[model samples]
Target: MLKLEDVVEMCRVPHDKKFRLKDHDPGWAGDEDVPKAKRKKFAETLLAESSAELAEAQDRLYAADTWSVLVILQAMDAAGKDGTIKHVMSGVNPQGCQVFSFKQPSTEELDHNFLWRYTKALPERGRIGIFNRSYYEEVLVVRVHPELAQAERIPDAKIEPSFWTDRFEDLNNLERHLSRNGTKVIKFFLNVSKKEQRKRFLKRLNDPTRHWKFSPSDISERGYWDDYMAAYEEAIAATSTKWAPWHVVPADHKWVARAIVAHTIAEAVEGLHSTYPEIGPEKLAAIEAARKQLEAEDSDPD
Candidate 1:
């Protein structure tokens, strides 16, 4: 089995200014020694173990109530982001985990700064918050289709050459602020191959149950694949920092993506070294007194 630590290291994108999406293989599953037939099974086992570890860590996190976690997932269409999230977080306590999927912004959302809506959905201390797609959309989607920015109604100053650079800086600063405030941020860019995406789209088109997921817009968007790729590369290079680095998880194989995501999350929580709160003497005494009363009542005959 591939070590979870090794898997995390393999997937983590370094803070390199010259980072290129082509350098990372979308179909690169670690441990090529494993038979192809068994690769999926191996990933499943790893995911299960990591999920259990994450669950235990979450328990301590909730009891400690000192830190929160924010998981940000960004990916191209048909990258299996939803499936990866469902499988990796299946074991977590729903009460302690919240997921927000950012789609087309509401008029009210567009009126505020790009980060406002996201800030409102941030996890409270001791919980895990997941952003299905996040503020990076401003850079990725809006950058790809500049017309979208017109909706935000920013002044003509937005057309300046430094506009994108400014957005990236804003994102990095927001994450830094979150980190300093006890929110651990984990970002994943599910790197799916264009070829695999096409295959998945075809599958969705053919399957009645999945037809709803297929849209005419999906086909239209594919025409801008290269533009989106360039946007992703630049945004990631600019925003991936020490406080919240992006994990470029190879997502052509759903199993591999799920395993890496589960492991990364578990390792992050475990690294916090958080523990359950200690009881004070007064609280211990109260607990003992309550225990005695309950025991006495149980022994009494009505």
Candidate 2:
């Protein structure tokens, strides 16, 4: 039985090479030798335990008020981005967590640099910020359709052979800056198989409650699957750094993916060793005096 910690290492993108999306297995959940039923049971149990730890770690992080965490999630359509966020983050204190889901940019957003909107949503110290789809879209989606890159209004000459490379450099610099400023970043590329995505799309079409999620454009985009995969591979490879490593999560099984994400977040925060701020002698004396005064008055009043 492989431990959850061991599983996490398998999902992390190595910082050395050009990341190839084809190298990762989308269906990877747990120990392959274990029976599927047992793996499922283990995942459920582990997730519940991890959730408790996450809540505790988050409280400590909030009290410490010295470090912030940012989680970036990117994936193909129906790859369970929303579900992963919903379940893995369920235990966090809402006051200490913020979620931003980015879609097509507004005209105002388009006027500024690609990272402008995302920087605006960066979490304050002692909070967790989640970006559902982030600035990476400028590379991934735009690379898949270079025509779209024109929206950024770069001079034609500058949008030469090095355009994508320059964008990647910008992303890397931004993440490095965040790290130096005490904001740690974790990026997840939820690797979902085409087959699974098709199944999910069909499921959404069949269920009335999920009808709103289905779109003709989503199907249209499916035709560019290969291009998107290539874009993701290049984007992840170029931008992944030690301070902001990417985790290529196998998102075929919702429960398994949720467990991985929850465990990753909890472990990252706990690793920071954040704690409630220590009280000074004067503060401690004040607390003692307050306690004694309350003790003296409370019983009689009651």
Error of 2 at 167 (Å): 0.6
Q: What's the lDDT for residue 286 in model 1? A: 100
Q: Write the per-residue lDDT of candidate 2 for residues 167-270, one digit (tens) a residue.
A: 99999999999999999899999999999999999999999999999889899999999999988988888887888989998999988888888889889989
Candidate 2 TM-score over all chains jointly: 0.95
**TM-scores, all models, native as reference:** 0.95, 0.95
Error of 1 at 7 (Å): 2.7
Off by over 4 Å in 1: 1-3, 299-302
Which residue pairs clash in candidate 2? none
Error of 2 at 203 (Å): 0.6
lDDT of 1 by residue, 1-302 (tens): 57767778777878865688898899988778888778888789989999999999998998899999999999988999889889988889998899999989999998998788989999999999999999999999899888887888887656554988998999999999999999999999999999999999999999999999988989999999999999999998888899999989999999889988998999899999989999999999999999999987857577
